[model samples]
Target: MDKDTGKAFDFRLFKRLMRHTKPYRLTFYGVALAAILLSGFAVATGVIAGDIVNDAISPKDADKLLFLSLLMLAILFAQVLSQLGFNYYANWLGESIIKDVRISLFQKMLGFKMTYFDRSSIGLLVTRAVADMQRIGEIFSQGFFVIVADLLKMLTAAIAMLVLNWRMALIVFALLPIIMIATRLFQKAMKVAFIEVRAQVSNLNSFVQERITGMKIVQLFTREEIEKENFRGINEKHQNAWLKTVWYNSIFFPIAESVSSIAVALMVWFGVLQNVANVGSENTGIIVTFIFLIELLFRPLRQIADKFNTLQMGMVAANRVFKILDTESHIDDLGTVEKEDVKGDISFSDVRFGYIADEEVLHGISFDVKAGETVAIVGATGAGKSTIINLLSRFYEINSGMILVDDIDIKAYKLSSLRDKIAVVLQDVFLFADTIANNISLKNNEVSVADIEQAAKQIGVHEFISSLPGGYQYNVKERGTMLSSGQRQLIAFLRAYVSNPSILVLDEATSSVDTYSEQLIQKATEKITEGRTSIIIAHRLATIKKADKIIVMDAGKIVESGNHKELLKKGGYYSNLYEAQFMAEEVA
Candidate 1:
């Protein structure tokens, strides 16, 4: 959960948001110019109404009245056009700004270290990227520029009032202080209410997203009723948060309306008295114009309070988004080396690392794999098997020591160039909601459809894929849920094979497959690892029997290192783990 800063106006945040508009400055300036025109047109319409009553009608000059009526209609037409430009251009600018911000935000998220995501909520991040971004955009579309135009109109109206009759103008302003103070109070109260609203929105999004994504787990354990009850509680909180804003609006707008009525009544009372006394230039026309001016002034007083709420919500959203943009959790790609044609040799020299501080997962582990060698790392469930893979790919940085590839520190290579030579197929294969061919190629135009088919055939999964309804064109759906676990694993193998990486990683890759797919995977494994350095992490000791080296780990340290038969001969940690972890699979 995020803490509320309880600020009414955050200038630093405001400036940060304004910087997004730099790319669309021309549209921003156009919107500003339209606002100015709108204010001017508004004041012109009010002044013309006054002239129609005072000069055009009083002398009963038919020609002058006809000309003035036509002029007023023309002004109204222009006002309509200006209003359209203001609304359209403002919204255009807002959408454009949010589009750019979302792009940057997505790019930033893509660059963050995997550990950052490990501790962050996917649902809450979705809320920030989608819902909160909309609110930030409303700052331009419905909040900032509209308020500026309204304020300009009010200032113009106030000047017109003073010029016509100073006494009546002073009477109108007598009630102004009361409304101003009420507005100030309303702004503060609504700020707090809206902050609560934003917080609840994120909570609601997170809850709903998690429940929906894990609905299978909920139903499997017969927890649907309990989950629904939990959701109802969250929904209630969300409703209550919104209702707080509603309650504030109900209380404040009425006070503003009462103030507006009082001002109108006072203006009418004094204007009538002065007209009767014949002391000043008080006429029916002046009183009529004052009515227009009063509406122009008091309406914005009511509306500015509402717009201020919009502005406050936008500021809150900006603060949240900027927090993500300011995060320094991205992986450091400081190395200038961009080697694409290198021998596949990997070394971990005294590598130490932790997912959390002072609780190391990899404790001074060291290993070396010669070019074109196949190595298998076997361990119990929490024996830091997967951590080695993550560190090799640089998904998480090591706390101390060095990881070298081809005699160069892994950190001393450009990230993309380094990762391009490496590929990993995990036990849990993730496929996008696209066709099988696209998933295999990863939408890489360089790998043609023919290339994908050739790789799948060479890997021995071509028959299995062709047996499906659409074969290569089959839509895997989200995370390949439509396909069986074995099928998904085969797809992962094909994906890696097509990339033709110099280094391959298989982390329990064939553990989920059935007997037939397991045979296919074994054949694919042999073909793919022929000319590349391969790292295999498997609990099935039989699969790694022919490896060039076998490294057995326990509690983050390598306990045994030898060929499979040699480790078995030693009757040490490897022999015991081989019996404990793989004997059941051998029996089945």
Candidate 2:
């Protein structure tokens, strides 16, 4: 957004972008060779035309003129063939590069720590992958190719023109400084405009995506008009940014064209003066040839200016993309040791963590969970209840202490292996738009239908699913919108059970369900947690009443911890909270 920073256009980012083209080296060379051949053929056509005119007007040898005409046709035909080949290969290379880039970016994004997603918007991320990638592709396919071809053509044309008539060529060459100077001045302005456009686009996308995703909240609050105004403001800013870019481009191209036109006019005037002074004969053939070559020279110059505009836009997009790719993950896998199997024993020793340093969310807390034990963590909202589960899962890194799994520091194990042993059913469940069976057997392609049915039956959702028109084959809409909240939670529970992990984590898994569904979930939880270490983070006091050990949290620390009856007898924070909730229920 700060375009005035001298570091706006980074060459290092351009170098990184170019690395994606490594796989298409052969195509690059092929296109370059084709451009050369095409340029030569184009210049030769002009020479042939001049010869034909001179021969026909003077009644020279017909055979010479005929040969020249045939040669011109052959060159033109070859040029067309080469252009086609070049276009095919260039397009293939550009698309292939874009595909590879998108894949790498996606993989890198997946590797990023969860905190990255916490701070970034889904819309901005999606824009980088979709729209920005397309812009970069256009730069490579059309912009880069045009620049290359134009450079070669301009160089070749200049040389040919000089060879034909050095005096006329020099007159045209004098205008080269104007283009160079104008481009130099326009480059910074264009880069600034493009960066503004890119920022505006990102902001607009974020606003639209957030509003759409939270439309229910808007409707509930009756703030649709407010949201609309907010969106309009962002959209207007984006439009203004684009208009500025358009203005720069409009001024740039016409100015470049005028400079080129002046160059051509200068050459024509000088050619006439030379003929009048008797330095050269007034040979219409030579004059026409010179005119054609000058046109060829200026044509590519104009193309270069156009390509520069596209290149600037690509730079802006790439800058944003690399900014994301360059971020270092705070949580990373360290290969100090590898454990093939974990006993599901977890211990936290003097653990501390926060999204931001110096603002601790979890203090120097310590706890232990033996294998095959259920530990319930309960707290008010924002008491770091979810943060504890996140740390145990290594979604975030602890600041000053270590978390051990089976008495081994979790960092020592491969992240994938560590996570493979644990399954979490979040309070807010998300299901892919797929059949019920496919969602359950997520990791196994060859899971039997009987096994899926068995898991569903164990979760007590089998009967409900069977009542549906398609049973296990029922297709879920996006985010499982086709199903009720309780149904979605049940499916998520089934998914966790099917994974057969050694440790189960249910964070408010039953909070969104009805009383009947909660009872079903409680039964399913007992079945699933049977010989596995389980951790439950819940706000509903009743859900954890039967937990083997209940840990009460307040202000990011464990205030009271004991079994249900013991905590009730202690008459502390846990007792007060339970009493308040009990009174509320009794009044209801």
Q: Compare the candidates by TM-score and give the number of the best one.
A: 1
Best by lDDT: 1
lDDT per residue (tens digit) for residues 1-588 in model 2: 754434535677678888888878888888888888878877887777777767754567788877888888888899899989978887787788878878878988989999899898899999899888877887677777878888887788888888887877787888888877777667777777777788788898888888887888999999999998988889899999889878877887788889877876776677678768888553556677767776788777777766767876777777777777788975777755656667899898988888897999988888889999999998899888889889988898888899999988888888888888989998899988888888788748667779989877876778878988799889997788898888888888888988888889999898968887787788888889988999999887877887889889888888888988999999998899889888998999
Lowest summed lDDT across 10 adjacent residues in model 2 is found at: 1-10
Q: Tell me each candidate's TM-score.
A: 0.98, 0.95
Residue ranges of candidate 2 with Cα displaced over 4 Å: 2-10, 270-282, 336-340, 446-448
| Each prediction's number of clashing residue pairs | 0, 0
Model 1, span 358-475: residue lDDT tens: 9999999999999999999998899999999999999999999999999999999999999999999999999999999999999999999899989988989989999998999999
True lDDT of residue 328, candidate 2: 91
Point out where model 1 deviates above 4 Å.
1-4, 280-282, 581-588
